[model samples]
Target: MSNPASATGTAAKAGLTMGALGVVFGDIGTSPLYALRECLQALPADERSASILGALSLVFWALLFEVTFKYLGFVMRADNRGEGGIFALLALSHGEHQRPRKGGSWLIILILFGAALLYGDGVITPAISVLGAAEGLESFNPNLAQYVPLIACVILGGLFLVQYKGTKAIGRIFGPAMVVWFLVLGSLGLWHIVETPAVLAAVNPVHGFRLLAEHPTNAAAILGAVVLVITGAEALYADMGHFGRKYIARAWYFGAFPGLVLNYFGQGAWALSHPGDPTSPFFALVPEGPARLVLTGLSIVAAIIASQAMISGTFSLTRQAIQLGYFPRLQVNYTNPDQSGQIYLPLVNGALALGSIWTVITFKSSNNLAAAYGIAVTGTMVVTTIAFYSVMRRRWRWPLLGAAALAAVFLLFDGALFYSNLHKLVHGGWFPVLVALGMLAIMHTWKKGKEEIFRRIYANEITEDELCNVAASDRIVRVRGTAVFMAGLARGTPLVLLHHVKANKVLHETVVLLSVVTEEVPAVPDAERVEVREIGQGLGVWRVVARYGYMESPDVTALMERVRDTGVPVKLTETTYYFNREMIITGGDTRLWHWQKRLYSLLSRNARPVRDYYRLPPMQIIEVGLPIQL
Candidate 1:
């Protein structure tokens, strides 16, 4: 008899793989709508057959090597506690050191830029995917082409509007919807392939090589267009922490990969048979009837699903950035109580919606937006490879020669792809670059300002002995109940506590210095969450350090319960919480430029209040304003 446990395992894996299809593969899976069309459009029309076969061959190997071998076979192994992303890779490469090693600053800068580039990708993916799908209406009725952008914008708006409902509710239908979407993709492609078996020969690498060898001038352009096929590859790795490597790989191999391959080949075959046809190969694959309209509707739904994945990924990335101190703290809502990863950021959602809609209106068509898409994806890939190399050498302790050889091979592909897209800078590629640079400046400024504040706060240290003496002093009156002071540093007494005592000349009978620390990992176990220590004998003063993963949001109320469990008298409702409210003043001497100082100050002012962010009892909280110069 088969083991019941084994059957259960298979069932759970199957469920996760189905979920991965909806969320992880949506971006790449939807590429067949536009990738092949754009690739063929970029090549010389004189040699149509050679170009079609070459483009198909190139796309096949690109997905196999880059998405399959590079990400799944290798990069996924570098996950930090089962979390994978540029940030996770950065943490792994840095190892146990809290600070970057010598010459590691460049790696940090590179990774930050890559993370910022993802915001650009987040904006473009939705615009292009929705527009690509909406363009299908043109094949049904030529006059509908003029209204494509409007239809796309409406779909994007509706998608963003429903984001407040959270991913769990929205995700229920994603798996089933994408399953149907991929099935249609495979069916259409297979139908065409049966009619023209000759297109299967495009699977050979020789055709891809011959295209480049024969057409030297258009080589870079050809590669640039071809990069579209693998634009969603990074999403596979970035979303790995959500579903895991095994399930995501299962989704790709069994569901997404075969469908994508067959569909792409079918598009190529259809293109060969109908030369000089101006209609979209994707929409043209189906007969001109209600069946085509159904396909179009399905494409729009798939595009929405693709956009949802990117939006969700952006929320996760923002949370990670804030926890890691690279960005200002924003209000994050946990949509699902069971899943910490399901989050909604109102500000981030609004910004992305606006950016995506603007892109749709500006580009006007999927083909136009395609010009702006590849650079951000390729730039991020290069950064990931470089960061992965550092992880191999430093964290995994691989031999230098082995790591270098492997990274060089990956770089040869990534670097070529990035270089090929460089000329696109003039052709709307500047959009993502501009967006990335703006984000980089904001992130760099926030981080620098925080470091400056950290250094300034610790410059005049208050030791435990000093705090104890103040507590025991005859001039200071000891009041009833508990006082919890929020601390920026794990070891130092919060400046707010010192200010409160100095201003009022009184102390609470029970004092708790609570510092919430975000570790580089994804999630910390409850048992290892909090560390508590008594400050002095019989003084009723304690130091508590609560550890959390970058993927987690700290709940002060929940933390207090853990503190009470530690035998410290921490009442959830009765305790009064104190927080430092910094009044930032610009124009002081600092490493940051004049403009950055102003921007940092602005971001600081707009950041969610500490009590609000932590969801503390607002009525019992007190804010002590402390003015600081940048």
Candidate 2:
């Protein structure tokens, strides 16, 4: 929503297929080779026959219901300024009913927490998806187990190896390779399906329902199996900006959806006919010897494509989070603007690479790793459901009955995955839960910190006219250069100014009280953009409100350049920027949890390097330390 020149300039109305393929399909595309396999691996010893069929059935329906209806059909339509993601949805639903339904004002806190957990999931998905695929090397050669760690290390290193150069170089390989990956998956699954025609019986939703009812004791885990199919479906909705809604829909419906369904059912068919085979269901589907060699080779390529997609998606999500203020500002390198297929985030890339390599070594194989994967991924899906319900009621204006019906259906599916993964709580599931908890702490801490600053700064009301009168007074001393005052309130007093006149006896003309206000709208139109008010005299108050799309960075200097033409007779030379340097005052009256107070202190200090992050001139920056405790 910022200018195209901001980062990889895909127009607001640019074509979306290529972008969607590189971004949206990354998580889902890799499912073809693993979703069914993981579900079957988790099945109980005695229930192989029924559980395998059930897992396949669940994967099929999960993809259809989660990706097709819940997200693509309805959620994508709710994009804010053609941008999609949890934050965008929150922006769309903001102020629709003053505060949200449950305890009202607390809803923002809930949405922020959900998004925080999503960030944790983003970190894990790439690690697990790639690690699971690289495990394929062992199935080809049992002796390869000794070398699995080495092989995984190489893959992980190679993955991060290409990130700095940007996605554009490898993007050409993504779509075409994914295309072949899908075809290979579908054809292999189709061949197996033909061999054992009865596997198609799982298509009936009743079979899925029957599988659970028949095996009540194992139903939760069975449904948990299917949830893997739709694990990445959330990304499709989250990355609407990378690829348009329509293109993602087309890609899923035409390419990814069919390929996944075929591969899953085919795995089920292979398991049924060749019941004695002990290897993974995926390997059993392939004919022996040279054919297995070919399948293994293709599987590796498909896995790489899948890994690339997840890696790219992670970069994009981090970018979105940083722009929305939920994440610390990150360094972004843009590869292709004509296409939304290329981007690189150094911090995220490094974190994911380390995490993936560590996971591979820790779990050793996909079978062992399978237990931990479902929990983090499903937790994200459940949150997506919560966010989607909000979308239905507010954005779509769906009736109570309609929203209830869809939510009820999806919640049932979510419940199964949730309960099943509960069995995995100790076995790797805790990591994601732990990660989510950490995310909650960071997000809530930031929210409370932001509010504390806003409330303190906004309490005192000072208009441009008041500042102008004070500057024009006979007794006031004047300082040269542009006085860039940072404000917390858009319509009230700014702490920087309040501190300025109180502490220092000097006042300067052209006072700019810049309050970076994140709007409910993703991109505010230029006319409705920044609110600039000149209070006459030489003293001017520019309430330059910065509105950022979830995918934008709010650079104060860039906005300053735009404000110059709006009646303020100010030149940009020798400008000085002011910030409230807060010191942690522990022994004082407070209104926050003790732990939250401590966290706020730490975050305030660590928040993006103020000068460099904001692109301000380092030598021109000034800090006025003021201690306050909430």
Candidate 3:
């Protein structure tokens, strides 16, 4: 007889593994629709069979080395409190510093750029995946080719529209659908592979080397297409926090990897048999019949799932950025009450929808969209490799030589893929780059402007003794009820609290100065979340520091409840929340350029208000305006 707890654990792991298949593997699993076809299309027609085998060989090893070894084996281990992503890696690399360490600005810039590139990936992934699947109609019927873009746009619109419902609801349907999808992928490929058993020889790495050696000039272009095989690899790490490393790895090895391998080789076998047939090997694998239509429909569904994964990842990344102070605050909605990770951002969704739909309408074909795809993926991959090195050296405290040797190996592959995609810059690759640059600018400005504001506000800070003296002063009127002043700085009096006392000449009978700090981790345990300090001998002036992980949003009401548990006389109903609303003036003296200052001001103006972001009650909230010039 087995233990009941063991059985329950096993069942839960299996459920998570299934969910991982739907969310984590969707992008890479759908690559069979276009990855092999793109590789073959990039090669010479005269040497069709050899090129097919070589491309297959390259794709095979790329997945084995890049995804299986580098990411899942190494980078996932660098997770920050069980959360993984570029930002998580950034936090780990910086050690325990809430702020960047000395000379860490460069690393922050690099990581921010990596994050910006992901937004680029988010835009292109949806457009290309849906378009690639929709293009299957061309093989189904030549006349239907013209309707592909329209169909893709409609699918994309619906996908974004349903985001408000969140991923937890959609993942339920997506999980089983993907299981069937992968089964079909493997079975179809296996059928073709048996017909041409020789295709299995491509498993040898020599075939991959030979392809590149023979066509040295075309090697870059060939690798550029091959990079598509592992484009979704980063999602594995980015979404690791949602699904554990064990479940994601289990899903990859058992489900995604085998299906993808068999399909690519099957496509290779099909390409070899039908030499000079200019049809897409993916769609051509099925004969012209109702079966082809069924496969096409499955392809579209799979494509939508792929797009959904990217969009969801973008939402998670944006939340992390905003909480970490790299980006301005945006309205974040928790889509699932049970899951904090499942969130939706309206502005982010709207922007992605417009960008994705515009991409579909403009490119009109997956082939054109593919030109814009690899650059962003490879660029982010390279950044991840570099950032991983920092984690190994600093966080893991690995030996210098050991870290260098391992990072160099990964960087070699990353550099080759990134350099190969450079030729695509003029051929629609500029789309992602343009998007990344815009995002980089906004992030840099927000970070810089925030720092300047913090410095200016705390320039002439008051000590606890000074605040306590003010509390004891006879000139000050003690009003009834409690007042909660939100402090930006964890130490000393907040400028807003000081200003309120000076301007209003009145203090609450019980004053609570609350400071919320975002730590360099994913989630803080509730026990370690709040710290309280009492000021003066008997005065009711208190300082509370509430610590939250970058993954969480602060709730003043909940925090106060926690404070009340600590024997403080704080009541949520009787408490009035006070916030500092900064009015950004761009023309003041600062290191920022005229353009950046203006941009920073614009972002600040549009940022979500502190009251809404912190979930403070509207009736008891008071906003104190403070003018800050940049």
In model 1, the worst 10-residue window by lDDT is: 1-10
State the lDDT of candidate 3 residue by residue for 113-147, as single tens digits.
99999999999999999999999888989999999
Q: Which runs of model 1 end up more than 4 angstroms from their true locations?
A: 1-8, 96-104
The RMSD (Cα, Å) of candidate 3 is 2.5
TM-score of each: 0.98, 0.89, 0.97
TM-score of 2: 0.89
lDDT, candidate 2, residue 596? 76
- lDDT by residue (168-236, candidate 2, tens digit) is 667667776677777877898999999999999888777777777887877766665666677777788
Stretches of candidate 3 off by over 4 Å are 1-8, 96-99, 102-104
lDDT score for residue 134 of model 3: 92
> Any runs in candidate 2 off by more than 4 Å, and if so which?
1-15, 42-52, 95-106, 288-294, 315-325, 328-345, 461-465, 502-504, 537-541
lDDT of 2 at 365: 66
Deviation from native of the Cα of residue 544 in model 1, angstroms: 0.5
Candidate 2 or 1, higher TM-score: 1
Clashing pairs in 2: none
Provide the global lDDT of candidate 1 against the true structure: 0.90
